[model samples]
Target: MADIATLFVAEGPAAFGVDSYQWVSLAMLVLIGVFIWKKVPGMITGGLDDKIAQIKQQLDEAKALRAEAETLREEYASKIAGAQKDAEKMMEGARREADAILAKAEADSEAMVARRQRMAEDKIAAAERDAVDNVRASAANAAAAASRSIIAEKHDAEADRALADKVISSI
Candidate 1:
């Protein structure tokens, strides 16, 4: 620090009555005097204030835009949530309808099977009845033939006359 202060003092004596250090100081003072005379500091302060105000306005606009973006994001999120719920509801309804259709198909299949089974049972009963009736008719024919043979083989003409006379006396 002391060395810097010595640099500002008129310590050097190189030519032309004044020291080189004093000439540098004189040039520095003239530059400061010119700056003060032209009112450059006030102009600089005014320019800085204008820049700060412009920056503040930009910040305010950015804040307003950010708020609007947040609002849009929230609205879109709500809409997406609602859409997902609607999709789920639709899926559930479709599932219920599919289940109902499956149940109906199962019931219809069962009923059809039962009806076919009943028809088969009726056919079997009819076949059994036909078989029994055929057997009864065959038995009756056989019995009549056997009786005719026995009567034809056993009875002579005289025996038949005697049987007729006996039956007439009994009547």
Candidate 2:
């Protein structure tokens, strides 16, 4: 049984006068020749080139997107600055208008005060004139009463008749 197992052992040269190592080398050479005949290396290199082109195209697209984003950011920043300036201008205009309105209100109030003062003075002057007229009328009435009493005390009926007869003979 041991001899039978040894009969197929690889302890000597292989068939067709070639060793097993030489046959393996020959098989490796034929495989290399077949790969060269099929242009497998060119195909691998061409596939690598195509991948590199695709990656480069993607990189270019990324760069363009980055540039467009930067442009949009700058444009929005300028618009925000312009909006702030416009808001400040509007606030300044409102302040100026408020000041003008306040000044006009003050002027109107002062004019109204002056007009009221003048009206009060005119009323006082009219009251003074009325008081003076009343005093004058009272004085005239007292004088007339005193003169009538004096005339009645000095003159009599006979003196009046003699003076009347003298005046009638002269006419």
Candidate 3:
């Protein structure tokens, strides 16, 4: 153990001394830093500019689309309003037509009812006239029969012959 410790102590300073390997490592580090400093910032700036341009283009397109949508909405709203007005006009016209038809039907029905009533009244009047004529004829026949019976009861055969002869002479 003691020999091993002594060997390490003897090599430590020699390994740390300025040498060809140290100079080469330092040169490599300086070259890498110089390359990054000269070229990397420009590449980063170009990438950022490209991304910003793309974002601006997308924003302009979105604005255009929104304006177009607003115009379409206004156009559609006006069309819907016109359609509604037309529908209301049609409905009003239909209602007026229906009312006219109903009024015509009512007038026709009233005229028909009046005609029927007049015909019925005429028929009733004719029936009453016929009944009156029949009563008069019956009364006349009954009076004639009563006169004949009274004459037959009052007179004998000879008197009846004499009365008939006289009635014929007078006529």
Predicted model with the maximum TM-score: 2
lDDT of 1 by residue, 1-171 (tens): 999998777555576787787788999999989888998888899999999999999999999999999999999999999999999999999999999999999999999999999999999999999989889889988988998898899978999999999999999
Is 1 or 2 the stronger prediction by TM-score? 2
Off by over 4 Å in 1: 1-26, 36-39, 129-171
Shift of residue 60 alpha carbon in model 1, Å: 2.6
Q: List, residue by residue over 34-134, the lDDT tens digit for candidate 2.
A: 88899888888999999999999999999999999999999999999999999999999999999999999999999999999999999998988998888
lDDT of 3 at 93: 97
Question: Against the hidden reference, what TM-scores do the models get?
Answer: 0.57, 0.58, 0.53
Deviation of model 2 at 121, angstroms: 3.9
The candidate with the higher lDDT, 1 or 3, is: 1
Question: For model 1, what is the error of residue 107's alpha carbon versus the real structure, in angstroms, after optimal superposition?
Answer: 2.0
lDDT of 3: 0.86
Clashes of each: 0, 0, 0
The whole-model C-alpha lDDT of candidate 2 against the native structure comes to: 0.92
Q: Candidate 1, clashing residue pairs?
A: none
Give the lowest summed-lDDT range of ten residues in model 2: 6-15
